[model samples]
Target: MSHFTKCELKMTNLTALKRALEDMELDYTEAQANQSVQVRGWRGQTLDASMCINMGKYDIGVVSAGDGTYDLTADWWGVETTKGISEAEFKDRLSQRYAYHNVLQACEGKGYTVEEERNEEDGSIQLVVRKWVSD
Candidate 1:
């Protein structure tokens, strides 16, 4: 029997996202972040998946786990917001919006039930997406 694993969709900004990807040394390129691309795990991995950036905000960015997912951001044209928005508030709002849209679209595509759980204190959201696969 094969066990199924769940993937977590953590929301962040573009600069941070880039930094994290670079730090992990994940093989990727800057293609609008929202553009669809097939993501194959490195080093003989079996998980072949696709992803795109669903949103980006200031130094933060959000991505969809699909090829045509939106690479949307709250940043002002690839630049951080200068509208006198605090760093903490900026990150929180951007992350929440990204989470909302990301899960909404993902679940809609899957045609499955989705339950949203929000963390107001941290300004984050999670979607309990129902996915079933048989081995």
Candidate 2:
């Protein structure tokens, strides 16, 4: 029997988060206003979350940490067995994707355009943003 666990992702941007989740091809429910989704846990356990990342026989959840950040909650053992992703690996993947989308969106909001997008040899991504200026 697996027990539920929670990890802080320190995520704040919802729009970027949505894109990140989608980019990973994950099935999830967005944060619903005034309502929380019930995330199924191990052995009939459950938790209510603002957003849900559904995995077969288990689920990961995003919840506000009461300090302007969000946490990722899950039955880590179950998820590892079902999805083959360890907790650290899951966090790293999601964090990387989230940062990628977040940076693009921030640059766009600041009137900058992406000039080059490149994936490096070290499993890292590089992005260049340029702003057009008129004298």
Candidate 3:
């Protein structure tokens, strides 16, 4: 009996998500059949996921809950593979990269140029963008 935990994300951008994952050098596969993953659970806990990220012995899944959002799902017991990565850490890194790419894309779309970019000591990214307005 295994249980998959679900962490709901703020938005759904499969393309951006994939790019973010690649930027982090994580191995993943994009779902094309629009199918969902079914898994068992402890105490009747179940999960239906839309996408999956290969993590060797285990996998992290993303479930689309409609309304422009998604949820990250994975079994807690199988989270750590030979790589010794945790589910929370994986989600955190993914979310960070996702946010980075999301902001980057938004800035580029609004005619803004990235002036400075750096990783802070707090494990967060700092970006400086600028857009000049002609009068």
- The per-model lDDT (C-alpha) reads 0.41, 0.89, 0.74
Worst 10 residues of 1 by lDDT: 40-49
Per model, how many backbone clashes are there? 18, 0, 0
**Using lDDT as the measure, which candidate wins?**
2
Error of 2 at 4 (Å): 1.6
Model 2 TM-score (2 dp): 0.95
Q: Which residue pairs collide, candidate 3?
A: none
lDDT of 3 by residue, 99-132 (tens): 8999988899999999999999999999999999
lDDT of 1 by residue, 15-131 (tens): 444444454333343544335343322232222222322222223223443453424332333233334554355445545554455556657678767755555665455557676
Candidate 2 clash figure, as a count:
0
Lowest-lDDT window of 10 residues in candidate 2?
A: 1-10
Write down the lDDT that model 3 would get.
0.74
lDDT of 2 by residue, 1-135 (tens): 548788767899978888998999999986657888988888889888889998888999898898888899999888999999999999999999999988999999999999998999999999988999999
